[model samples]
Target chain A: MDKTVNQKAWFLVLPVFLVVAFSAVLPLMTVVNYSMQDTFGNNQFFWNGVGWFKELLDPSTDLGGRFLASLGRNLFFSLVILAIEVPLGIVVALSMPRQGWTVAACLVILALPLLIPWNVVGTIWQIFGRPDIGLLGYVLNHIGIDYNYVSNEIDAWVTVIVMDVWHWTSLVALLCYAGLKSIPEAYYQAAQIDGASRWAVFKAIQLPKMNRVLLIAVLLRFMDSFMIYTEPFVVTGGGPGNSTTFVSIELVKIALGQFDLGKAAALSLVYNLIILIVCWIFYTVMTNASAERKPQEGAA
Target chain B: MARIDLVDLAHSYGGNDAPQDSFALKPVTMTWRQGGAYALLGPSGCGKTTLLNVISGIITPSRGKILFDGEDITPLSTQKRNIAQVFQFPVIYDTMTVGQNLAFPLKNRGVPKAEIDKRVAEIGRLLDLEPYLNRKATRLTADAKQKISLGRGLVRSDVAAVLFDEPLTVIDPELKWQLRSKLKALHRELDLTMIYVTHDQTEALTFADTVVVMHDGRVVQSGTPAELFDKPAHTFVGYFIGSPGMNIIPAEVRGREAKVGDHVIALNRSYDKLPDGAKIEIGVRPEFVEVVAPAPGLLSAKIERVDDLGRIRFARARLGDAKLAARAPAGFTSPDGTAGLKFDPSHVHVYADSLLVEGAA
Candidate 1:
């Protein structure tokens, strides 16, 4: 018997390789180069040789101080956003009807916010939350509440959190809705026959079925919240006294605001490393949970 | 086990002019005996599932009273009705182990831990799922998952009834026969009331003691399989129950005989009370029809097609404007040209205006 084979299929992957090399690898190499050396205005450089790393890791240094603070802030923000958005999204998804033009209308409305650019979201919120002319602030002041987001640290933090929720909660809701829709009607009938309460049905059938999509929602929200910059930058300018200064905002301050090339490079690398490690941990944990419950690979 | 009674039960999806357009289930009044296995058999869109759902309290009848053991249960929810249902596809929790899935209802009802374990083990054994008890349900094959679904429904022994809605449709042919027999044995052992709904005539006839033949949203006849075959209450039942169904030949009733195109067939009993000018049809099971070599018979037909189903050969022929089918033993052959057909007067059924005449046979 003769075997038939096609080796020319390698050509199909060439364009993908070139695109990744140009887009991802090139920028990554530049960041790696910047992290190792100190440069002055005259295009002359000095071998820092991990000097920036030592400074950033040292407990006594200002860079170290900002690094720890921003890391804590970012972690807190991501956790809060996940805690709020996931449940809220699930509630919204469940309340939506299962059929007809209404479902289409709800989906279109939910997706509208996701289509807006991040910078535009930030700009819109910045203007919308103004103390003097903005409708929200005007209504609040008329209702006799001293609502000043720009000057109050707590208010700024609250505003940023709320903005993030409004901008991204739909993503989690949409994912959950898709998961819910994919569930077979048979499961619901079974639950009905089992005399399962509404809560039991949701806990046993809906939640377990939505696990894969929920993991995606969590990881996406975590990574995006960790690297969030444009919205907070446009709204608070990392202000109300560094209260809303997340890691990304701090990295920009060190790189462009202070012109500390060596230190900024080290800080940026550290930030990237933190994200990669956390994301890896999240992925590993979720994948293991799902795989452990996956039915045996093959059975008759 | 308790007997269920449905009184004046009718359901309509939306109000419309014609009955078919409005009501999925026409008004039905019937009583199901305790611990009896019953089947609602019909083709698709014949309202079998709708009737089953109404009995299970999943769909409330628009006009009816449902009584379980002489108590009105029309207003009760499905959970309150204490009925277990098995669906067309398996409905097991994929994340839970097979043992856990079986134990879920008992646990929810606060059954003692020891009792739960014993019940789960028994059900697992019953379903041949003991080997996969510790394995997660999602990893099992489709058939295995369906077995788990069946186990879940059967685990709670104190439930009022067990309803199956085409539950074996997803199983492969070989496995379907296996599981169906298993279900029959389980019903005998448990002595539980079981109502199975299926469009397949074989499944209905083989599994249930009493087969409820339904058509166009109403129950036409409910009786033993033999009764449905030998003495159908309605013309629809005569045409719907058998293989190739029963041959319905259009005829004009004259006194005590039925007149086909050019010949008259004698009826064993007379229906002189039938209204004048009433259009009628003669019904005969394919098994009772005899094909002869131009003997003194009622009508002559040309053979159209022949179907050989191993043990039996069914010959389809046309008589005048009506089609007739006859079943004979495997080796029976049809002649080359026109064939004479004769029906036993004792087996002949006379229908007037789509309804069986009172005294005609």
Candidate 2:
């Protein structure tokens, strides 16, 4: 039996395609237009022909130097976020209660930080880290440590990292919790019967089970942290010597503040390409590890 | 191998709040002779798995002790008990090769590497898993995975006994038969005491030397297959053991005679306790109840249906509102409307309140 070639079915898909093209493709083409040419004023453009892209690549120019530094900071922030969150999430997920009303309570509490809007989280932390009235800063200062998140560069970076960790560790924990839940009781029972220790069981059963979800968590955390703008902008306003000004902040500054649309558009493409490449690497490594975990079939 | 003794063991899922009737396993005492093959045959929720779990030390019995060769092992854990169990579903480490899965139990015990390899190879070959030793356990068919599960159990040298909790339930029928035979062969060769739990009667009867039939959390009877077939200790056994269970007809007992509806049937043994309040019945297997021609026999029955089952034929009839099934040889003749169904004197079993009367056949 052969399925009829339903060419008419594409008509149903055409609406979605048209909507995506109008919403995403049109704006992206405008960005591409801005990136390729120099816009001197409103409604007037000069065909620069990759001139802006060339200027954006050179570190000597103001826009290019800011873009490279911000890109480096974005990559570093993403790495730091992942490093703190993944293991911390797994540990938290492991310690979480598996059953009863406590599970609901824990899940709700774990999700509370995630539910608070991003800028709101930044605002909350901003007030919470103030030296005069906030608990953290006041306690740290009284404890004989010079702690001020506003003016201190290291302190500001610590505050951002801590805020990011508090905000997103729940996502990783939730994902890992789901992964841990999917493993059957039989596997644990079998491991127990085989006299496997707790660590052995985690290594053989829990770790392998968590691989796929950890991949998703890593990719999501990386992408979200790389393109982060709202939270840091609300908290520190990209101050303390331009330390926390990531790629998104730099792009916003060039595009909206200085109105350098061409440079910002090119930087946005570079930033998008970086994320795409890194995410592809993450996905490839994770999937390859999973595929490798599957022991080979016999020749017969 | 060690002899397993369950001493006055009982289990209830609920704690102090457990109702009296909620006992999953009613207090029972039994012993399994070392190196003997035994089958715990029962229906679902009959406490067979509970009993197996208790013996495996997975569950501590609410009361009583489990003794292995006269040593109380009830307080020990599963690993301390050193027993192997195959569950209903196959369990193999999906990440490991077949060889690794087989050798896992041994490796966990800190067995010498050379010994582990030898044992793994031997068990793998016996289960016909040698060719797929390097293959991943996850890639195999269900039967092959089940073979790996069984191999895991066999890999351990210090196992007290191997317990199977309906281990073949997941296997295809054809592979079930094959695995059953392989298990039987292993039992014979290794001289290991094995207790198999299953609801299938044929598997129980064929695999076990002694079959302990359980019902409602209590052991109804434990006997050889032949004894269970010939003289079921309880009416439950009589009804549960046979292919088409036993026929139980209400009867009134007096001296050496019994009254079945409107007819008087002679009993081989006299019953003194023939009170009107007591429930009395005659239990007979279809194989034992001989069908005779026409009417004017001891008890006349109206033939409802006759099923020719290749080698054996069953004549189902109604006699005074009591349904009777009698098995006969193939090509047995049946009358048009009515026929005489008589219980063989030696095969007739009398029961009082569902309990078999001793020496009353």
lDDT of 2 by residue, B130-220 (tens): 9999987877877888778878888888888998999888778888888899889999999999999999999999999999999999999
Q: How many clashes (backbone atoms < 3 Å, residues ≥3 apart in a chain or on different chains) does model 1 have? A: 3
Off by over 4 Å in 1: A1-21, A100-105, A135-147, A281-300, B15-21, B112-115, B130-133, B295-298, B328-335
- Could you report the Cα RMSD, in angstroms, for every candidate shown? 3.4, 3.2
What's the lDDT for residue A247 in model 1?
A: 90
Runs of candidate 2 with Cα error greater than 4 angstroms are A1-17, A279-300, B273-277, B328-336
The most accurate candidate by DockQ is 1
TM-score of each: 0.91, 0.92
The CAPRI quality class of candidate 2 comes to acceptable
True contacts kept of each: 0.70, 0.40
Tens-place lDDT per residue, model 1, A65-182, is 8888888898999999999999999999888889999999999999988999999999988888887888877787789988888999888888899999999999999999999999
> Model 1, residue A256: what's the lDDT?
92
The TM-score leader among the candidates is 2
